[model samples]
Target: MVIVFSFRKDPNALSPVNCWHLILSQCRQESRDHGALSEIYSNNITLRLSHINEDVARLSKKSKEIGVQMQEELLKVTGELQT
Candidate 1:
């Protein structure tokens, strides 16, 4: 989902880049923001994303293990019911 926000500009509060940045920032990912532009590298992004994928894979394996165990218990209960 996308979010839209409106903020009033205060000339004294922030520098032009910072002020405008706050308003414009909500429109897109912060990765496109000025600070990230210089410091963020493609390889850094790939490494972080790979870590996220690894976490997802680990969670998926755990979920499958729990599901299989539950199915086995249900089958045992069904066998008792049949006898």
Candidate 2:
């Protein structure tokens, strides 16, 4: 037994090489755009984290100062009562 295959040339059907080339070019462009987007996302996240860290540091410093003031006031009041 013998098998035969036939191919027809249609104007609408792209050649294999042309199809592959077009697909590769489109993929390259999409990859470049995605890379740029990823970089922007990373930078924005870093900036937000840095801002949050600075706010935490400032709050901690203020809390310590308030605590010290309270301790001093308490000590003065107790000393006067003991006299």
Candidate 3:
């Protein structure tokens, strides 16, 4: 792909070499942009995973606390029924 830059006053158009340079420049810029976007996406995913892990840990702790409480209540009720 190439672009011909010409004007009415200027008879000279863009050379093929210049066109290739422009194309390569645009390609390099696009590659950099893609790399930056990929990095941002990866960071976001890592952050979200960290948050999820923290939430899971918190829920697990709460579940254990509830389990202990239930066991205590059951023991108390059993003792009352025996007496």
Candidate 4:
């Protein structure tokens, strides 16, 4: 038996950190199930870890993009005021 799990990023969530914690909790519960014990659990854990990594990467990229945009806007405003 094989079980695969995929996680999607939610833009409206509080933050990736919180979402990752939620995922971890869910995975832990799933792992505790005694009905079946096989490679699926290991696979699921790996998948969850990968999802968390991807989420963190995406969040970091977005943060950097927003920071750059804000900096540019501030520079533009400062330039206009000086002129």
* Best lDDT among the predictions, by candidate number: 2
Rate residue 79 of model 4 by lDDT.
Answer: 100
* Pairs of residues at least 3 apart in sequence or in different chains that clash in candidate 4: none
| Cα lDDT tens digits for candidate 4, 1-83 | 99988877777766879989899999988877643555666778789999999999999999999999999999999999999
Query: Which runs of model 3 end up more than 4 angstroms from their true locations?
Result: 1-37
Q: Of 2 and 4, which scores higher on lDDT?
A: 2
Q: How well does each candidate superpose onto the true structure, as a TM-score? A: 0.51, 0.55, 0.55, 0.50
Worst 10 residues of 1 by lDDT: 34-43
Q: Residue-wise lDDT of candidate 1 within 31-54, one digit each (tens)? A: 567567556756688789999999
The lDDT, on a scale of 0 to 1, for candidate 4 is: 0.87
Q: By descending TM-score, how would the candidates be arranged?
A: 2, 3, 1, 4
Screening candidate 2 with a backbone cut-off below 3 angstroms (N, C-alpha, C), the clashing residue pairs are none
Better of 1 and 2 by lDDT: 2
RMSD of each: 16.2, 4.2, 8.1, 24.9
Which segments of model 2 are wrong by more than 4 Å?
1-37
